[model samples]
Every structure is written in structure tokens, then in C-alpha cells.
Target: MKVIHVGVGGFGKQWVRVLRSSRKVRVVALVDVSEPALAAAREAGGYNGRVPCFTSLQEALRAVPADALVCSTPPDFHREQVVAALRAGLHAVSEKPMANTLADCKAMLRAARETGNTYVVSQNYRYRPEMWTIAELVRKGGIGAIGQVRIDFHKGVAFGGFRAEMEYPLLIDMSIHHFDLIRFVTGLDPVSVQGTAWNPAWSHYKGDCSSSVVFELSNGCRVVYDASWCAQGDYCDWNGNWQIEGTKGTILYRNGEIRLLKVGPRYKVESSETMAPKPPPADSQHFVLADFMRAVKNGRRPKTDVYDNIKSVAMVFAAVKAVKTGRKVAVLDKDSR
Candidate 1:
């Protein structure tokens, strides 16, 4: 597969690296609005040998023929770039938070549907082995029907860029991963969201850097999430700390360790099992790239296809609505794929 990658900024560089390492796809063109970023990505992507770089996806597409377009641009730019790519009859893979708005997500979905091209959102957390194990355990009834889930995340990093200027930095940019993870692990679709987003006094970002959200899932599970990007003290891993409660037991995951606690006949902690961390089968992007290739080849929807991923993106938008309106908002129902 030949690919034209858009956006060569911070996160964009990661996409470039993944494309260079991919055995099934070749990045034939690089596109970015910034010339310096384009040059850096060209060197960092290790495609310095006469590969074309352009400042715009349109120009790049006009100059080259490619099987797919990888969109690593910001959320606001995703709709235009991805819709254009799909309309051009190329399969597209976009970074998380498919687009800034639900309307844009739906539009992208419609474009991909009309074009009969694969549109995948890279929710890489789903490809982790631990996440798969959690999903499998819940599916197999190891913990019975999940009733509640709690996730707490804290990280202190001074991000000095456009992210600092975006609205709801924590909820839109970071919390989407956890929201998607909740749905992925519990096999539940979000029904409603209630949340508030705020920024600490010491924070540098203009957008909210902290958030608390309560989500009601389709399966009667309640997920409570609290996160901060400006925390100063002890912090959880990038994946966050998770506590899942089910009818029969509970599952705890923190610092890359998994532990299960089951109730005893006497109402005590009967069994406790700790699982050693298992490496993923491949890099997250590799998994996403491979699935995209397979779906294109088999003419089937990929695991994180836009139709399915829109739910996760909706969760973010719904949460933002809740924060703004000071009331709960319903998540959009998934349309027929």
C-alpha cells in the first residue's frame, strides 16, 4: 500500500515513524502546513531518498497516486482532510477523536460509506494485551456482569503548543482513550455522560486541564473518571489506574499490573490473582496498520472502523456538552454499519 501522511507535528512524527516501520505500507508522500515540520519529519521518518513532501494534502494527492491517506492532523483539521481523502477513493486512517464534532464524524462516516472505503480511527489502547485480557475476562464471565468502573489519571507535563490553546484539553485529547477503553473492556456502549472540566490556578493551558465525568453504559455499568494533566504529586501510568467491580468480584489494574479479587463463601476475599505484564503482539500502530491492510484486502470493516469508533468520539463531545450545559447529555446511538 502507498500512503500519503498528513501533519508532521509532534504526534504526526509518531505516525511517520510507524509508517516507516510498517512492512505492508510505504509512505510515498508527506504533507504538513509547516515547512520546518515537513523537513524534520522527512529526516525523522527516514524517507530522505527523493520522497516528495508537500505543504498540503491536496497538492500531495494531485502529485502522487496512493492507496491510502493517514491523517495525523489536529482534531479541527481532520474532517476536511479525511473527507477529501475518502472522496478521492482512498482508504483513510485518522488519529483518535475522529473529528472535533459529532457532525464531522458522521460526515466522515457517510463519505467513507459512500466511497466504499475503509475509515479507521487509531484507538491504539485497544490493541494492548492487557486491554484484550480484560475484555476477554469480562466476556467469559470471569468477573460476572460488571456493575461499576473507576479510572483515575494524573500527569504533569508542560505541553507548549496548540494543545495548550485547544478547548477541553484533558477531556478531548486525553480522556477519549479512557472512554474508549471503558467501552472496549466492558462491552458496553455509552448511553449518557455528565461531566465538568476545569483548569487549576497554576496551569498554563487556556483549556481545562482537569475533568471529572460520570458515564452510564448500555449494559447498566457506571463509569467514573477523574483526570488531571497538571497534577504535581504522585501520578498513575499513562494508561491510568482502573478498578472494575462486577457481581462476583473486582479487577484492579495499576502501574502495568493486573489483580483480581473474588468473594469467598464467608464473604471475605477468597482468591487473589496477579498477572504478569504481557507485551502486546505488536506495536499499537502496527496492529492498526495491519488491520487496515487486512480490511482493505478482504473488503471488510476494520476493528476500529469509523462506524464503530464514532461512539467513542461521541463520548467526548457528550462530555463536553455536559460540562458546558451543567446537565447530562445522551450519547448518539450507533447507526447501521
Candidate 2:
């Protein structure tokens, strides 16, 4: 696939790295608001200067022939940039959050529909081995019916720029990853969400860096999300610690380990077995790009395609509303205003 890559800095650099390593992909053009960022991307990705650089995506699209446009811009830019690509007869692969708001996501989705072009949002966490394993177990009825899910996502880090300044940083910036995983692992759509966010007295961020978000799923399964970005001590891994309980069994995934246990009559463990995560065919962004490329080639919608991803984006906003209003907020859908 020939591609035009936008936003060549920060997470965008990682995307450039993945594109560079994929033999199936040829980056036809680079687009960034910063000329220095474009130069840095070429240097870091070992790209020859022959790959044309452009400060404007419009110019890049006209100058280069491409099969798809890879958009890694900030959330606020996603709607316009992705819509432009779709209108230009190019499939779009976008960074997560889809956009800063659900309304923007809908606009992008509308563009994809009107243009008849595939638009997929990159949701790399859904491709994890643990997530796949959990999905399989639920599909196979290893867990009769999901009842509840608990997640503890505590971390201490400082990634400056947009994240530090954003209000509800933990909920907006990080919790969406966990929220998407909840939707994927259970195969259940979120029905509603309620949550709260706060900043610790000694926290560095201007925004609240701690939060507890609760999601009520389609199957009446409740997912309680307890996460903190300004936490101290005993930091959980990025995937966080998960305990998914169902009618018959429970799956405990902490750090990188997975354990499945059968439930007895009175909530006692009837049996226990430890299982290693089966490796996914492709890892992280590699898997994401591979899926996107295949979808573009096949003229099919990719996994986490705009429509499917909108629900996850909605989950984030619903929680945001919940935090702000102090009430349960219903998750909206494609037809929502």
C-alpha cells in the first residue's frame, strides 16, 4: 500500500516506525504542521529525502498518488483531516480518541459513509493477547455470563504537552484504553456510565489525574474502572490488573499473567488453572496497520473501523459527562444527535 502519513511527531513517530518496517507499505508522502517534525520523521524512520514532505495535507494528497492516508494528528484535528482524506478517495487510518468529542467522531463517520471510503481508528489495546484470550473464553462459555469487571490502573509518569494540561487527564487520556478493552473483552456494548475524577493534593498536572469510572454494559455487567495517573508506589503495568467475574468462572489478569478459576456455590473457588497468553499474529501498531492495509486492499471495513470505534469514543464522553454532572449518562449510538 502507498500511504500519506500526517502528524509526524510524538505518537506519530511510532506510526512512522511501524510503516517503515512494514514491507507491504510504502510511505508516499509526509505531512506535518512542523517542517522540523517532518525532517525528524524522515531521519528517525531512515526515510530518504525522496519521500516528499508537505506542511499541508491538501498539497500532499495532490502531489502524491496514494492508496490510503494515515492520520496521527491530535484528536481535535482528526475529524477534518480524516474527512479530507475520505473525500479524496483514500481510506483513512486514524489515531485513537477518533476526535476530541463524539460529535466530531460522527462527522468523520459521516464523511466515510458519504465518500464510500473505509475509515478505521487505531485501537491497539484491543489486539492484546490477554484481551483475545478473554474474548475467546467468553465466546466458548468458559464463563457462563459476565457479571462484573474490576480494573486497577495506577501509574506514575510525566508525558508533558497536551496530557498535562487537559482536564480529567487520566479519564480522557488513559482510561479510554481500558474502556475499549472492556468493550472488546466482554463483547458487550456499554449501556451507561457514571464516574468521578480528582487531583491529589501533591499532583503535578493541572487536571485531575485520578478517577473511578463505572460502566454498565449491555448484559447488565458492571465494569468499575479505578485508575490514577498521579499515583505513588506499586504501579500496575499499562494493561492494568483485571478481575472479570462471570456466572461460572472468573479470570484474573494482573501484570502479564492470566489465571482462570471456577466458581463454587458460595463464591468459593472450585478449581484454578494458570494459562499463558497466546501470542497474537502481529503486535500493537503492527497488527493495527496490517488490518488497515488488508481492509483497504479488500475494500472492507477494518476492525475498530470508525463506526465500531465510535462506541468506545462515546464511552469516554459518557464518562466525562458523568464526572461533570454527577449522574449516570446513557451511551449514545450512530443515530444519536
Candidate 3:
């Protein structure tokens, strides 16, 4: 499959490298506003001297005959680029958060539907082996009807200036991944959410530094999530700690370990086991690209298809709305405009 990638930023460069490494894909083009980044990507190989680098999407699209487009652009530009790719008769795989608003997501989905091309949102957290193992256990009834889920992604890094300057805050920029992961594991849609956010340590950033959200899913399961870009501590890292509790057992995933605790009459003592650590088959960017290529080749829907991902995007928006209005927000209906 021939693919063209947009953005070429820190994450975009990773996408290019992974796509080049994949046996199923050829990186045909690279697009970015930054000349330096494009230059660096060109020197990284696979394109050799033939890979066309463009400072604009229009210019790149005109030159590259791509079967698929990978969007690693910032949140604001996702909608326009995704719509453009779909309109250009190519399937699109977008980085997380889909877009900044429900309107943009709706428009992008509509375009993909009209074009009859697949549009995937790259929520790679779902593909992590640890999370997949936990999901499997949950699905197999090892967890026996989930009761509650708690997810926390905290980091001490200040995000420098890129995230600090955004108006949408950390939840919109980062929490979408965790929210989508919850949906992936539980296979339940969040019906309503309530959240609170604050800029505790005061930064130049316009949005809040820390946020906590509570959600009620359609299946009567409750989920609580906490995320912060301004967390301060020595041991704090980015992986995010997660715990899921069910009637039969509880799953705890932190650092790199997946632990399960089950209680039963036969075994009065709680049983515990630590899952073996396995590096992601390929980095998430590579896995997502591979999945997209497979879908393109076989004419199948990607696991993170637009129709399926729009809900996760909606949940992010709902959390943002909940934080702003200080009230519970209902997720937007899929059929509703």
C-alpha cells in the first residue's frame, strides 16, 4: 500500500519510520509546514531522493498517488486534513482525539461515508498487550460483570509550551486515550459524565492543569478518570495507572504489570497473578499503520473506524463540557447531528 503522511512532527516522524519498516506499506510522501522536519524525514530513508516532501497538503496531494493518508497533525488541523484525504479518494488514519469538536468529527465522518473510504482514529492504547490481556480476561467473565473502573494518567512534565498554550486543557488533548481505552475494555458506551478541572499550580497555559471525571456507562457501570499534565513528584510518569473491579475479580495495571485478584468460596484466600511483560509487537504507530494497510488491502473496516471512534471523541467533548458547565453532560447521540 502506498501512503502519504502529514505533520512530520515528533509523532509524525515516528509514523514515517514505522510505515517504512512495515513490509506491507511504502511511504510515498511526507507533508509538514516545517522545512527542517521534512528534511530530517527525507534523510531517514525509504524515500531516498524520490520521496516528495511538501510544506502544504494541497501540494503533496497533487504530487502523491496515495491509497491511504496518515494524519499526525495537531488537534486543530485534524478535521480539515482528514476530510481532504477522504475527498481525495484515500482512506485516512488519524491520531487521537479525532478533532477538537463534535462538529468536526461529524463532518469528517460524513465525508468518509460519502467517499466510501475508511477513516480510522489511532487510539493505540487499546492495542497494548497488557491492556489486551486484561480486556480478554474481562470478556471471558474472569471479571464477572464489571462494577467500576478507575483510570489515572499523571505526569510531571510541563508539556513545555505546546500543551500549555492550548485552550482545551489536558483532558481534551490527552484524556481521550484513556476514555477510549475504557470503552474498548468494557465494550460499553458512556451515557453521561461529570468533571472538574483546575489550574492548581498556575501556569501561563489558559486551560486547567488537573482534571477528574466521572462517567456513567449505558451498562450501569461507572468509570472515574483523572489526568494531569502539571502533576509534580519524583516517581510520576506518563503510562497512567489503571484498576478495574468486578464482582468476581479485580484487575490492576500499573507501570508494566497486569495483576488480577479473584475471590471465591472454594478459594477463600484472594488469588493473585502477575502477567508477563511483552513489548508491544511494534510501536503503536507501526501497529496502527499495519492495521490500516491490512484494512486497505482487504477492504475491511479498521478496528478504530470513524463510525466507531466518534463516540470516544464525543466522550472527550462531553467531559470538557461537564468541566465548563459544572453539570453532568450527556454524550451526543450517534445518529443526531
Candidate 4:
């Protein structure tokens, strides 16, 4: 599959590297507003031959004939770029939050439906090896009938630039990963949420620095989330921690280890196990790109397609609304139109 990458930022550069490493994908073009970013990505991407670079999406589209596009641009530009790609009859993989607003997400979904092209929102946390292993355990009833989950992501936003200036800040920019992960692990949709947010320290950021939320899932399970962009002291190595409590047991993951605490007829105890840190065979970016390529070849939808991502997008909007209103918001019914 011939692929064109839009937005050569830090994440965009990673996309180029991953796609280039994949045997199924060829990097046909790179687009970015900054010439320096383009040059840097070209170097890191290791494109020995001449690789087309463009300053504008239109120019890149004109220059590259691609089967699919990866939209790694800023959140605000996601809708426009995705619609453009779908209109051109190319499948699109986008960085999350899928768009700046619920309306924009809906529009992008509509465009994909109208164009009959795949629109995937790249929520990579679901693809993380440790997270995937935990998900499998949950599905196999290792922790039987999950009742509650807690996801916490606390880290200082070191990447200071346009991302810091965005209006929605942390929730829109980062929380989608956690929201998506909860759904991915439990295989449940959120029904409602209550949230609170504040920007106490990072005065430069237009959006909230910290947010706490609680979600009621459709299957009577509950999820609690805490996301922050300001961690004062030494940052945690992985930037987050997760815990799930089930009727029969509890599962927790932190610092690359997973523990299962189960209570049975014999005794109740904490059985802890650490996952060996095995780096991806190549890189995770390569895995996602390769998965997308195989899906395209076999006429299958990638794991993170538009319809599958709506729950995650809905969770984000629900949290934003809950923070603003200081009241619980129903996610699937109240937030989604």
C-alpha cells in the first residue's frame, strides 16, 4: 500500500518511520508546514531515494497517488484532512481525539460512509502489549465479571507549543486513550459520566490541567478516571496506572507488572506477576501500519475504525460536558447526537 503522511510533527515523524519499516507500506509523500520538520522526518524515516515533501495537504495529494493516508495533523485539522482523504477515495487513519468537537467527528464519519472508505482513529493504547495482555485476561475471565475500573494518567506536558494553546487542552488532546482503553478491556459502552476539571498551575494552557471523572457503563460496571497534565514531582516512568476490580478478583498494572488478586473458596490473596518487557519485534507504529495494510488487502476493517471509535469519542465529549456543567452526563444518549 502506498501511504502519504500529513503533519510531520513528533508523532508524524514516528508514523513515517513505522510505515517505512513495514514491508506492506511504502512512504510516498510527507506533508508539513515546517520545512525543517519535513527534512527531519525524511532523515529519520530513512527514505534513501527522493521522497516527495509538501507544505500543504492539497499539494501532497496532488503529488502522491496513495491507497491510504495517515492523518497525524493537530486535532483541529483532523476533520478537514480526513474528509479530503475520504473524498479522494482513500482509506484514512487519524490520530485521536478524532476531531475537535462531536460534530466534527460525525461529519468525518459521514464522509467515510458516503465515500465508502475506511476511516480509522488511531488510538494506540489499545495496541500496547501489556494492555492487550490485560484485555485478554479480562475477556477470558481471569478477573471474573469486572465491576469497577480506575485509570490514572499523570504527567507534565513537556512538549510545549501549539498543543499547550488548544482550547480543550488535556481531555481533548490526551484522555481519549484512557477512555478508549476502558471500553476496549471491558467490552462495554459508557452510559453516563460526572467530571471536574481545573487549571491550577499551568496558567499558559487554555484548557484544564487536571480532570477527574466517573463513568457508569451499560453493563452495570463503573469506571473512574483521573487525567492530568501537571505532575509536580518526579514523573512516573509510564505516565499512568490501571486497576480493575471484578467479582472474583482484581487486576492491577503499573511499572510494567501485572497483579491479579483473587478470592476463592480456599483463601483470598494477592497473586502478583510481572510481565517481561519485550519491545515490539520492530516498533509499535510498524504494527499499526502493518495491521491497516493487511486489513485493506483482505477487505476487513482495522480494529480502530470509525464506528468502533465512537464510544471513545463519546466518552471524551461526556467528560468535557460533565466538567463544564458540574453534573453527570449520559454518554451514549446524552452526548452523542
Candidate 5:
């Protein structure tokens, strides 16, 4: 397959590296608005003078023979880029959160629908071995009827670029991963959300760096998610700490280990055991790219296809509304809104 990859700085550089290593696909064109980023990506590997380079997506679409497009641009530009790619008769994969707003997400989905092009969002966390285990357990009733889920995420770092200035940095940029993960694991759609966003006085970010959210899922499960991007000490892993409570038992996942505890009759303490995670199928990015390619070839929707992922984007928007209004906001589906 021939590909056109956009954005070549920061996370974009990583995407370029993945494209360079893929045996089934070749990057035919590189696009970036920043010349410095383009030159730096060219210097990094595989995409030297042989491949065409453009500063604009429109020019690349007109000039390149691209089978698909992999976009790593900012969330705000995702709608324009992905819509253009779909209209150009190219399948597209975009980094999450799918878009900055629900309206933009809807527009992107509409383009894919009208063009009959495959559009996928990179919800990479769903591909992890641990997540796979959790999903399987929940699906097979290993944890019984799930009543509640708790996720606590914390990381202390400084990436002083677009993130520092973005509003609700923690909620918009990071919580989507966990939100998507929850949806994937429980196979439940979110019904409503109540949230609060805050930034500490000592924090460096201009926007809110911390948030607490309550998500009501379709299965009558309540998920409490708390996160902070500017936390100072004792941080959790990138995937965070998670606990799932069911009628019969509870599943605990912290750091890299998974544990299951069964409840005895009459609510007594039963047995607890550590569950082993399955070997990962492949690297997360590779899994996503391979899935996209397979979906395109088979004329099927990818697992993280935008048609379904738009709901995850809706969850983000609903949370934002909750934070602003200090009230629970309904998660509106496509037909309703």
C-alpha cells in the first residue's frame, strides 16, 4: 500500500518511524506545515528526497498516489484533514481524541459515510495485552455483573508546546484513552457524565491539569475517573490504576499486574489470585496500522472505526459540558443530535 503521512514533529515523528519500519506499506508523501519538522523527519529516515514532500494536504492529495493517509496532526485540524482524505478517495487513520469537538467529529464521520472510505481513530490502549485480558474476562462473566469501575491516572511531566496552552489538557488530551478503554472493556456505551476540571495554583499549564469524572454507562455501571497531568509525586503508569467491581468478585489492575478476588458466601472474604496477562499480539501502533490495512483490503470497518469512535468523542464533549454546567449531561447518540 502507498501512504501519505502528515505532521512530522513530536508524536508525528513517531508515526514516521512506524511507517518507515512497516513492510506492507510505503510512505509516498510527507506533509507538514512546518518546514523544520519536515526536514527533521526526512533526516530521521526512509523518507528522503525520493518521496514527495508537501506543506499542505490539498497539494499532497493532488500530487501523490496515496492508498491511504495517516494523520498525526493536532485535534483541531483532524476534521479538515480526515475529511479531505476521505473526499480524495483515501482511507484515513487519525490520532485521538478524534477531534476537539463533537461537531467536528460528526463532520468527519459524515464524510466517511458519503465517500464509503474507511476512517479509524487510534485508540491504542485497547490493543494492550492487559486490556485484552480485562475485556475477555468481562465478556465471559469472569467478574460477574460489573457494578462499578474506578480509574486513577497521574503523571508529572512538562511538554511545553501545544499541550501547555490547550484548555482542559488532562481531560481533552489524556482522559480519552481511559474513556475509550472503559468502553472497549465493558462493551458499554456511556449514558451520561458529571465532571469537574481544575488547575492547581502551582501547576505550569494554562488550562486545567486535573479532573474528576463520573461516567454512567449503558449497562448501569458507574465509572469514576480521576486524573492529573501535573501531579508531583508517586505517579501511576501511563495506563493508570484500575479497579472493576462486580457482584461476585473484583478485578484489580495496577502498574503492570492484574489480580482477581472472589467473594465468599454471605459477603465473607474468599480467595484472591493474580491473573496473568496474555502475550501482546504486537506493538500497539503496529496493531492499529495492520488493522486499518486489513479493514481497507476486506472492505470492512476497523475496530476503532470512526462510526463507533464518534461516541467516545461525544463522551469527551459531554464531560466538558458537565464540568462547565456542574450537572450531569446526557451522552447523545448520532441520531438524537
Candidate 6:
């Protein structure tokens, strides 16, 4: 497959490298608003200054034909870019959040449905071995019916960009990964969200760097989350420390380890097992890329297709609403997917 990659800088730089490494696709064209970034990505992407670079996706599409369009642009630009790519009959891939708002997300999904083009949001965090193990375990009844979930995430990041300007930096920029991972592992749709987002006086960013939210899942599971992007110490994994409790037992992942606890009477831990994650060899973008390729080949919707991923993005928007209004907000309002 031939690919046209847009926004080849920062995180896009990593996307360029992943694209170069994947044998399933060839980078035919690169697009970026920054000439310097295009040059840098050209080198880092191992295109050897040979692939054509354009200032816009439209310009690239006008000049070259490609099987897919991979966009690493900000969420603000995703709707327009992705809709155009899908309308042009090319499979579209995008970095997370889908779009800035639920309406825009729905528009992108509508375009895909109308065009019959594949639209995949790269929720790469779900492709990890540990995530797959958790999902498989939950699916196979290893944990029985989930009842409660606890997640804590802490990270000290100073990305001197738009992130600093977001009102809920930790919730909007980082929480999507955890929110999507929860939905992926548990196969539970979020029903409602109630949360608070705050910023510590010690924080450097102009936005709230910490958040606490409780998501009511479809199965009445309560997912309690506490996260901080400007944390000073005791940083957790980027995927967060997860403890999902169910009727049978609890499955937990912390410090890069997966463990299962089998419960007995009165929630007594009868036995414990350190599980070795059994997933495909590829991970993160590598694994997502492979899945996208197979879905394209089979003419099926990819795992994180826009139809499904919008729900996860809705979790973020709903949390933001809950924070702004100080009230519980439905993850999916009267308008159902």
C-alpha cells in the first residue's frame, strides 16, 4: 500500500519512523506546514530525501495517488483532513482524540459510512501485550463480571506546545489513552461521567494538569481515575496502574507486570498468578499497523474504527462537560451511535 503522511513533526516524526519500518506500506508523499519538519521527517523516516514533500494534504493528493492517508496532525485539523481523504476513496488513519468535538467526530464517521472507506483512529496504547492479555482474560471470564476499576497515572511532561493551552490538559490530552484502554479491555461502554479537573499552584502549564473522574460503565462498573501530568514524583506507567475488580477475582497491571488474584469467600485471595502476556509479537503502532493492513485486505472495519472510537472520545468530552457543569453527564446522550 502507498501512503501519504501528513504533519511530519514531533509525534508525527515517530509516525514517520513507524511507517518506514512497516513492510505493509510505502511512504509515497509527505505533507507538513513546516518545511524544516518535512526535511527532518524525510531523514528520520528513512525516505532518504527521495519521497515527495508537500505543504498540504490537498496538494499531495492532487499530485500523487495513494492507497491510504496517515494524519498525525492536531485534533483540530483531523475532521477536515480525514473527511477529505475518505471522500477521495482512500483509507484514512489518524492520531487519537478523533476530533476536537463530538459533532466533528460524528461528521467524520458519517463521511466514512457514506464513502465506504476505512477510517481508523490509532489508539496505539490498546495494542500492547499487557492490554491484549487483560482483554483476553476479561473476555474469557477469567475475571468474571467486572464491578470496580481503579487507575492512577502520574507523569511529569513539559511539552511546550498547544497542550499547555488546553483547559483540561491531563484529561483531554492523556486520559483518552486510559479511557480507550478500559473500554477495549473490558468491552464495557461508558454510560456516564462525573469528574473534576484541577491545576496545582506548583504546575507550570496554564491549564489543569490533574483530574479525577468516575465513569459508569455499561455493566454498572465504576471506573475511578486519578491522573496528573505535572506530577513531581512516583510516576506510573503511561498506561497507568490498573486494578480491575470483578466477582471472580481482580486483574491488575502495575510497574510493567500483570497479575491475577483468584478470590474465595468474603473476597479472600485464594491464589495469585503472575500472568505472562500472550499477544502478537508486534506492539503499539507496529501492531495497530498490522491490524489496519489486515482489515483493509479483508474489507472489514478495523478495531478502532471511527464508529467505535467516537464513544471513547465522547468519554473525554463528557468528562469535560461534567467538570464545567459540576454535574453528571451521559457519555452518549439521547443521540445513540
User: For candidate 6, what is the TM-score?
Assistant: 0.96
Tell me each candidate's RMSD, in Å, in order.
1.7, 1.6, 2.2, 2.4, 1.5, 1.4
lDDT of 5 at 216: 94
Prediction 4 global C-alpha lDDT: 0.80
lDDT (Cα, tens digit) per residue for candidate 6, span 223-322 = 9999999899998878899999999999989978999999987979999999998875688887778888899999887889887898899999899899
Worst 10 residues of 3 by lDDT: 230-239
Q: Which consecutive 10 residues in model 6 have the weakest lDDT in total?
A: 328-337
TM-score of each: 0.95, 0.96, 0.94, 0.92, 0.96, 0.96
> Compared with the true structure, what per-residue lDDT tens digits does model 5 show for residues 54-76?
99999999998888999999888
Tell me which of candidates 2 and 4 scores higher on TM-score. Answer: 2
Q: Write the per-residue lDDT of candidate 1 for residues 243-309, one digit (tens) a residue.
A: 9988888889998889989965555778999966555667688888899999999988898998888
What tens-digit string does per-residue lDDT give for candidate 4 at 1-337? Answer: 7888898777787787677667777878888998889888888888745888889887778777988889998888999999998898789998888998989988988897788888888877777677777888889898889888988887876657766787658888888877888888898878899989998765567777788999999888888888777776544434278889887888888866778777665546646555554443434556566667778788898887887787789889889999999998888853243
Query: Which one is best on lDDT?
Result: 6
Off by over 4 Å in 5: 335-337
User: After superposition, which runs of candidate 4 have C-alpha atoms over 4 Å from their true positions?
Assistant: 237-239, 265-267, 273-283, 333-337
lDDT of 3 by residue, 1-337 (tens): 7888898877887777777777877778889999988888887755768888888887778887988888898888999998998998988998888888888888998998899999999988777777777778888888788889998877766565457777666788788888888888898878999989888755556778689999999878899888877776633334478889888878888887888888676546378988774555655666777777778789898888888888888888888889999999998684422
Provide the overall lDDT of each model, using Cα atoms, as 2-decimal numbers.
0.87, 0.87, 0.81, 0.80, 0.88, 0.89
Pairs clashing in candidate 5? none
Model 2's TM-score against the true structure:
0.96
lDDT for 174 in candidate 1 is: 83
State the local distance difference test value for candidate 5.
0.88
Alpha carbon lDDT of residue 285, candidate 6? Answer: 82
Residue 185, candidate 6: Cα error in Å is 1.1
Superposed by TM-score, candidate 3 places the C-alpha of residue 281 at a distance from the truth, in angstroms, of: 5.7
